[model samples]
Target: MTTKTFLKAGLIGALFSAVAAHSALAFPANMTTDGPTNPPVGHYEFCRSLPQECGSNPGSAAPGVLTREGWKKILEVNYEINQAVTPMTDKEIYGVEEHWAYPDKVGDCEDYVLLKRKRLIETGFSPADLLITVVLQPNGDGHAVLTVRTDRGDFVLDNMRNKVLLWSETEYTYLKRQSEQNSGRWVKLQDGRTVAVGSVSQ
Candidate 1:
């Protein structure tokens, strides 16, 4: 192409690059996963039971914006799920290996998050917004909770609390969480962020 045409093309390409970079940066460094790994076994089981929830619902998540209604839904789902499921240690329920699944009669922390995510998806909430996050509690125990991504900020829906709180407000140290792009894979949160997995503390 002519010199003028080449320069125009270059300018357009640079503009697109900047937009992509900004979008990437929009995801807080704390939120991006360290890398992607296989989906947990319990998630596999959950998919077998509720195939629809596990399957891709394209464009299901909201536009990264948390509205007044979205906030209300978060609180409602957290309280309802927390009250519905009876908390029990994995050893008592499944024994060994972090078992993450949807809670029916009883489940551990991850199970609570799974159920919350399922119900929220059913309620027309985007699966992308509802992420399963793993964190180290203050007492040096590993814990699982639902991390809801919103325009307002990342909020946590924990089995430990009926009231939803910002992820930063919680006592847990950030570790890893499911990637928003794909539910089957998980990524580490930040470097040197680690915690122990104690039996269901909540």
Candidate 2:
């Protein structure tokens, strides 16, 4: 599935890691099997940073120019090279699935974003720019999206697709920025159609 495809329904229940056909995969490389690892405590502009507010600093999650190490960090994903994430896959991370339930090689979309955000912070991206965006696919399906604010603009990291794409490059309409609201929870988008959150649409 395309990045937007999986994201539209909070997918990523499975991860297909292939070096050739699906080289770009794995995503955040979360800390534990339970779920995504949270960012360091020092990073939060305040407990009220995400959804509750835009954060004290505007450019927190923005990873503009990555250093050599930082680039490596940003690119690092959860892949066991030479090991089969699946029997058919050759490389570490092949790709990801969103809607499929009980995804052995996958997880929820939130996990992907959490891992990505954590790794970026370790590399040097400010915690502010990385916004957790809940959006609907062009078809009005549910999903989650991570927006990495850059000096140029925002780059979207998705589990469904491999390479990162700009926000505009993807078709999913922006529903609500995780850091924009005070409740720190998912919100509906105006002017655009509505989609379910955390659930797949038939």
Leading candidate by TM-score:
1
lDDT, candidate 1, at 136: 75
Cα lDDT of model 2 by residue, 1-202, tens digit: 3324533442232112211223233332111112222321212232334433333445333236534343333334322111112222212233533221212444455445555665565556776656666667777765665676554345577776655555645677655554422213233333122333442221
The TM-scores of all predictions, comma-separated, are 0.70, 0.47
For candidate 1, the per-residue lDDT at 175 reads 66
Candidate 1 at residue 93, lDDT?
90
Most accurate candidate by lDDT: 1
Which RMSD values do the candidates have, in order?
Answer: 14.4, 13.9
Q: Kindly give the stretch of ten consecutive residues in candidate 1 with the minimal lDDT sum.
A: 193-202
Model 1, span 47-108: residue lDDT tens: 67767666543663453666655655666677767777899998899886656666788999
lDDT of 1: 0.66
Model 1 alpha-carbon miss at residue 168, Å: 1.2
RMSD of 1: 14.4
